[model samples]
Target chain A: MTNRWTDGPGPRLRDVSEDELLAQIFPLLPRGGPVVVAPGDDTALVRTAYGSVLATTDTMVRGRDWLDEWSSPADVGGKSVAQNVADIASMGGRATALLVTLVADPETPVAWVLDFAAGLGAAAAEIEVPIAGGDLSSAPAGTLMVSITALGDVDGDPVLRSGARGGDVVAVAGTLGRSAAGFVLLQQDRADDDEDLVREHVRPRPPYEQGPVARSAGATAMIDLSDGLVRDAGRVAAASGVRLELSTELLRADLDRLTGVLDDDAALGCVLTGGEEHSLLACFPPEVALPDGWRRIGQVGAGEGVTVDGRPRSGGGWDHFHP
Target chain B: MTNRWTDGPGPRLRDVSEDELLAQIFPLLPRGGPVVVAPGDDTALVRTAYGSVLATTDTMVRGRDWLDEWSSPADVGGKSVAQNVADIASMGGRATALLVTLVADPETPVAWVLDFAAGLGAAAAEIEVPIAGGDLSSAPAGTLMVSITALGDVDGDPVLRSGARGGDVVAVAGTLGRSAAGFVLLQQDRADDDEDLVREHVRPRPPYEQGPVARSAGATAMIDLSDGLVRDAGRVAAASGVRLELSTELLRADLDRLTGVLDDDAALGCVLTGGEEHSLLACFPPEVALPDGWRRIGQVGAGEGVTVDGRPRSGGGWDHFHP
Candidate 1:
């Protein structure tokens, strides 16, 4: 298998080799801001409107979270940041910075760690966030685990899970089921060395800026798609005390994007039940025009449970323990 | 050994089993003016005066950082908070809050997780800093890892590692090397199961408030004792371009505390070289009266390297890869 060291580029640790994937990713970060500290310290520090900061953390482990054959270190790092940053965005906030902690086995190459950092750095930069600081530790098992804490600033009211109204439109920004579809493809091509599918499984492309877009669009309630559509939708449904009815026809274009790559059932399954898309799902007033890159997938009604084309969908998505 | 579920006098995760750990840690948090969002839905929000927040994360893995046989979950949780929180304090700030992400093996007892959270809660409460938020996931290995990110508000000046001047008074707050001694005792009594020594090894009592104390005392340079005095002191010495000379006489009290519990050589080794004490070491102008809970332990000179009583001390402390 091609490791990150031989396949990517970036600054490698002095004692450890550098990963090849990092070379392609590091240039994507944003620079210059009230970001007094970014991408290298213990944590990134940024200027907030009211001088208040928001922070959250998420951890991913190999075997349980991702497989080596399906993902590179950079992909691992990118997804780590994406999930944590989305948490910040879901609160109607802008991500300002991040801090990451990594634990890997001794047998794991140092280059993998460097590549992971670069991937995390690149992803943060893409969203104008920087890696402020991090810590590295050694684990005994052959596992690679990363913990990222994202910090953000609240410029307006934090759109909480409890904010959605009964008569709101349920919408989404960005593609769905791509990562999950990629996971299925990667599993099929694990030994075939399919770079494209593997890359998708490893590194997710989250709609980083869409959170602000949804907020500006006057969206009432929102969450990121780390879990499948139905599960994540269930969260908003349960919290907002409204039934969410999704129109599968609205998602036809998204499904078409994955058609040639996945079978009909797989594509539909991915779109409905896949997770880790990092897409923003929100409820808005009927009067609010759907923002660019956002699709109207459903509507909020006075009921409970999520429906796909007016029927209940089954087997939502992957759960850490259940999976 | 009593597990968390069986021992702790606290609530359990019955209906909230699927909820995130941040959900639990949030409501228990005491609200304050500095707190912006108290960690219900996603991230915890805090106000910073420096227009920037200082953040850091560290992960402690089972077996690598601690042995399950000797340590209780509470001890592991406390150390995780102590070490990460100490990083922010070393930068001359008080830990305002924290976000912890825990990864554990599925077979791991549920009781352990609760105990660990309780330990974290107790430690955060002790410092008056709440357990603002967190993430939890299952791992494949028999490991229990914790990653904590600590946030602090910078008041006046950020006392960076690159700040010390020549000829400064080197001082320390809180006791030194007790945890190291405790570690040694535990190692010797691994089979005996000495609860005191094991507790010390697991839960280090950091002088949490001493960070701000040293900062207010006009410390030119500061760091916490996660690495041994000489090693961590070396970091300040190298960063500040000054030499550090530690007086053994000032450490007599510490030596006395460990004497009966530890063999002479082992005790002295732990004191001078062992790590994770979380004591504050600072350099200031010689004219300043040492603050309360602080003792004059050394002098900053013109040359480089750490000298104990006049001779070079041995290099000792935990190394990430080597450990």
Candidate 2:
């Protein structure tokens, strides 16, 4: 059957029924990973190796979270998955499946949705997680939003941010401030000058495997750096009842990498205050060996809040409601 | 700490930071179920009795799903949770936890958000399920959307829509056509005429416990009636590769309840075609005794579509993209 919606000339969502759209979408989404009952059923069922499940959800809005001028539908899909899965990774678990929900204007093009699903499927496939099921709804014109709920399984105890103790070493896995740098470049219309940073902003590749590795290596507390480092670390400090003492000398490599693309102050600012990094921030016991790809940069101390070189540092990060 | 945003008079979402808003909401939301690590963490961890998890998601938009003039923020929150939990019920599972995501404009009032969370938390607590965690995002002006993902635990095999046989008898748990009747009343500005129907339209009370009851009674197949009766039954018919033979005589009680509100044709239409009822429809062996609270409505036969009194019937339901 030639679908007038999929094969026809630039069909919009309003031109097709919900079932037809779902039929087209089911094939585009990632499948085949611990799925017992998939999307055709009322609820998708997935087998869990562990008795417990790690659950997290994140939403992305069209105009607020990303502009159509800067992000394609595919990039938005990939980025949304990145942020949600990073939450599971930070919990010391591996994502088993995802439930996605998309609310779009009726005028949204069918092609755009397909590209988004394809990109989302590709990203989930890369992590071996299935897009088990989701919901779709039509919205008022010019409104587009996507949300993903990631479910994960952990073999042992799930890591929490409150587990950090005094004398633990603070370490990180993955880059810092690159996404913020990319945001700055996009704002300055200099995105072409730093393609790698710009790409990281659009589609973050969180180190999924390292989560279990860190857990196995006995990390005390872990969190994904969605907000700026100082801000997210402050959350760790508050939750664990300990202060994080940092040294800029240990972060010289991250700062130097951005110096070529930005001024010294801007580079330092991005490294300290940029958001949407999706990097792993974890604390290890002083005697435990740091896993590969982990970089130690700070230590846990008997105090509260974050500090840099013995001086207090204010938490500066993106707050969704704040400007 | 006095929250200038929540305690102050009518503060908008933009007036407070995300953490402040969350702190206000977390206290209002229902907790204490299988939650191991709750909302304060990167991801919430939930314990599941079954090794497999039943996952379903549903989304509701401001203008499309419900009008602010007609439905209160609490109504929206309650309705969203009802729809999601209904899906899990149809799968013969009890919901263990929920992850909610809200995307609203910056101008949205904090009071509205608090009411929404209160309603959601109350609904979840009634079923003994915890609101594990969620995400909040700011949207463009005039946009408000809520999405929920429910995770469930099933004791044994989940009843699928494809398991019905020709000798199965169809039964329905919960009311039919009430929400549609309420919708019509609301559209005609006669909401004051029947407060019960209008309330049902706003906040559906699905028979959540009857789902597991039906499963234990040896139901062959089951589905939630989110769409109209005939339409959702058609889905079961298609999935099971059998025809559902329904009788208007059997549905007379459902029709009679609405006849006072509308004409005979309209009443029958509402009974057969009203959506968002959140009722469960299940098929059982002819010899199996019907569970309490379930009324016999139809029979399964060897065919491919739905039939009303031996005549072929077309599925009629609400399509999100269609008028």
Candidate 3:
């Protein structure tokens, strides 16, 4: 209300109408992958393969999800897509389109929205998916929220958490604890010490292709390592009614990667309980060979819960409300 | 954070973990329309007919979209689904599934969430679409937002806004100014005098089935009247490169219904400039007969913009950022 729109280096959202803002943002988005009808209509029409589509949604709030000082608008945009894309991949599906929603304050700068759109468009383009359509709204002061719902299709059966059996081998397809380590370093004001860890924490690059490949190679169960290895693996254990036996020796590579930036106990903690990693964790039959990027980290056995080196491990991961 | 969870009649979100809250909510949601895989999975799988899916998303925020004093949790839930469902319908597609996202403060009451889910589930049940899956995250204090991404499929080609031609008859399938009139009544503290108007403002019951009906009957171009009739008609006009000539005499019935509660000028204004109305406005070839529920109010001619009785009308509708 105080003419914040005119005082900034660029125009704020309050200075422009919704249509005007959309005109500026639409050109920055990715188009034409399964998109029969693009944005600007009541609804967008996208082609679905195999008659079945996979659906998932994820939301991130400004203060709770990330700090502006730590994450650029582009980082938030790319991370939002990566998290949702990982969900589809975990289910053995390839993403085809995305529907995004941005609810921000009227005082939000126009540059932020355009930069965020660019980041989202780049991420979607990397995966060969289109930004089909989305909604934009203004929220109360100090509130900025973004959400993405990714739609995908699978050629064959989708992998479920309940499908793992006693003789299955557990594996992971990407880096572990890097995001969590990056957060810790940033919190301790050691961000300048390690660029890779900081970058991973802000913008993770999950191995999305490994998901369908694992499914094609007969993956019994799969999940995205969103809430860390311990908590997510426990989910698979409870759903499949079996115990996951992890060996520290098998996780040595992950631990070693973090050890250079953290103490021994801290490194182990990061490897076991880091959240927002977005890696794919899966289980396959013992007779089947592991996929190219997937490394065996554990095994499924007749029991419940997850244990490291035959001992029950504790220290849970992120919880939205309880945290 | 200071014991807000325990002092309430029901537990707050902070009192339970994400999984615990999800356990309570999954039961309150509708399932089994086109759902091949339900909630509790990484992503839900839904069937899409005719190899094409219609995608659209909308978001609502507290203190901007609605106020707790005027709308109950159930009303908000139902309105969210209705708005999204209307978009899909306007595109001449039958909604197959919905993905919802909720971002709330940690102090949000668990009972409020359950009630919201009940309302959403009931609305989806009425339309026979399943609530496939969604995300939940905690936001900063005093923030509550809800969003839904709807996926639908069309039997034939989708009716786009650019398809209208000159000499097409313009019609509407549902109420026009009821929602705007309702909001006006609420703002004037005249709630005790007209329950119907206030109810329409909070919970709109859109004519969902009429979308496909008009399409099957050869509708040329179609759009949802989410914004006021004038604004939405302008969109169709701009996209189709035609002018819409509206006649007030044809809108006499709509004006008459509102004049009982409002003055003649105010009634006409409401009918023409009301927002949040989920009715369908469409164009049809002059040779085609009007559908059962549709009423002719105008005609399409070669030109641009919308005209009322051969005169151009001004006065824009809701603009999220500008408003």
Candidate 4:
């Protein structure tokens, strides 16, 4: 793991006292807004200004979810925050605060935790979500993992996947396949040529603002592209008891974005089956003008499952365990 | 780890697909009430009628936090919930919902998870907190970890540790030192003599209903004894910029409870320096009437740190990394 530290000049976490380590991490934590009580308390008090709150939790583990050789600590931090935020957005809510649990081996570097905090703090600040409260603990040697739970505020009637009707138009609020392409590039050792793809694989930029926009404009059902387009869309289809007929013609632009970098088969598979994009997928009723950045990609019908150009998808998406 | 499993057997987690495992766990999840959306969603929606919500997260690892040989899966789950909820209670809040993240190796047992969920759901139901939603990811072999974040409702002015003032009475809402005595009992192989003490080590019974009781009775500040009495009392003392004067005579009863199980020095040490008791330690203004369950053991004064009969403590309590 130390050999994989591509960046230079920092002391290991083992060299610092726990109190001193926390002292360094504290200033980076978000403060002042909806966070009535901040870190260092038994629990943080937050005001959502709404009757309801949306919450979700996710974890990232070393060697399994990421390799230090391929990802910077900051990238790991950012992705962890992004994925949790995306979960809130998928439910048509805005994230208000986050609680982080950092479990690391004693030998882990102080710089890694600080860098990870930078990414987590930056992502939270970007969405106006405060880093509320969390615990830090030790793990067995060589293991470093993080768990983050995010709380969100639903401003109005909470939108859910069960609401998509037969006549609703399906849409996407962010890019797809780039993360998969970037992952492929990294796997092939060709990452040096494509910084954009590599960054996409490392730090996904989920459409956070678009979640509220879609909610305001009446999104029937929504999900984030965490398990890839086909599989996630299949979930929305199953939940709503409607068939999602996606048009590859509408996604021709998506295919066009990947044409040169990958072969035809690789590009097609990446677009349909790749996960970790963190983009928003949604179904909207007819006559609702989509807020900007959303593109119409298909329609909901009185059937089941997800289909591309009227053909059912043969392969599923990413599996966290198997992958 | 398998040898550590003493109970009747079930299928391994690897035997079922992740979806199948989730399906088995979902029916056991608690739903309805303030939960607008249940498990199996991108995120869960919960209603917090108050203007503010209390949030906290805690994690337990297999090897570091508990050995499988000493703790059943149900014990692990219950402890996880109890500890997290205790944090919220320490803040004078009522636990409302919980989001759990369980990371295990592929070869782990599915029944372990189902049983874990059963314990978690039962604990949450006991407190009226729904299981809500969370993510499951794979870990490297020989790893199993659980992280739970509890959201709490602060019905009124939240009691913070910093609020303790001079002349305040320092008290505890639940029994102290039993958990430490239990640990010693287990270590000495005399656990069979006192099943109650051993049960305290495996799963602490924190007085959940007493947090709000103390608050309503006008507690000035509060903290949970997760890290031991002397250490946690020192925290409250430091935060309030006051000295806590603990009386040995007052705590003699606590020591008496451990008389047979531990030597005099060990029993005294367990009462003062042991961790994971999860009891509420609080301060109340002199004029305020104390709650029924709470027992006064000390007093607050205009000074710093903590003292036992006016003498400073000789040693500190648990340090997560070092311990």
Model 2 lDDT per residue over B79-174, tens place:
998998998888787777776777877566555665677677678767776656566677777778889888776667777787899989999999
Q: Note the residue pairs that clash in candidate 3.
A: none
Answer with 2 or 3, whichever has the higher DockQ: 3
Per residue, candidate 1 scores C-alpha lDDT tens digits across A1-323 of 43232223432222121222223222322233333433221123344332556667778888888766556667787888888888777766777666667786655554455556667767766766654556667776576788877777756556666567877889998788877887887767643444454455577777767877788889898888777889888878877788888988989987997777788999899888888777888899999988987889989988887888889765444545556
What TM-score does model 2 achieve against the real structure? Answer: 0.85
Where is the poorest 10-residue window by lDDT in model 3 chain B? B36-45
What DockQ does every candidate get? Answer: 0.12, 0.12, 0.12, 0.11
Candidate 3 global TM-score: 0.85
Interface RMSD for all numbered candidates:
18.9, 18.5, 18.2, 18.8
Q: Give Cα distance to truth, residue A233, candidate 4, Å.
A: 0.6
Which segments of candidate 3 are over 4 A away from where they belong?
A1-50, B1-50
Tell me the lDDT of model 3 at B46: 42
Would you estimate the TM-scores of all the predictions? 0.82, 0.85, 0.85, 0.85
The interface root mean square deviation of candidate 3 comes to 18.2
Candidate scoring better on lDDT of 3 and 4: 3
lDDT of each residue in A240-296, candidate 3, tens digit only: 899999889999989999877899988888889999999999999999999899999
Candidate 2 segments exceeding 4 Å error: A1-50, B1-50
lDDT of 1 at B18: 19
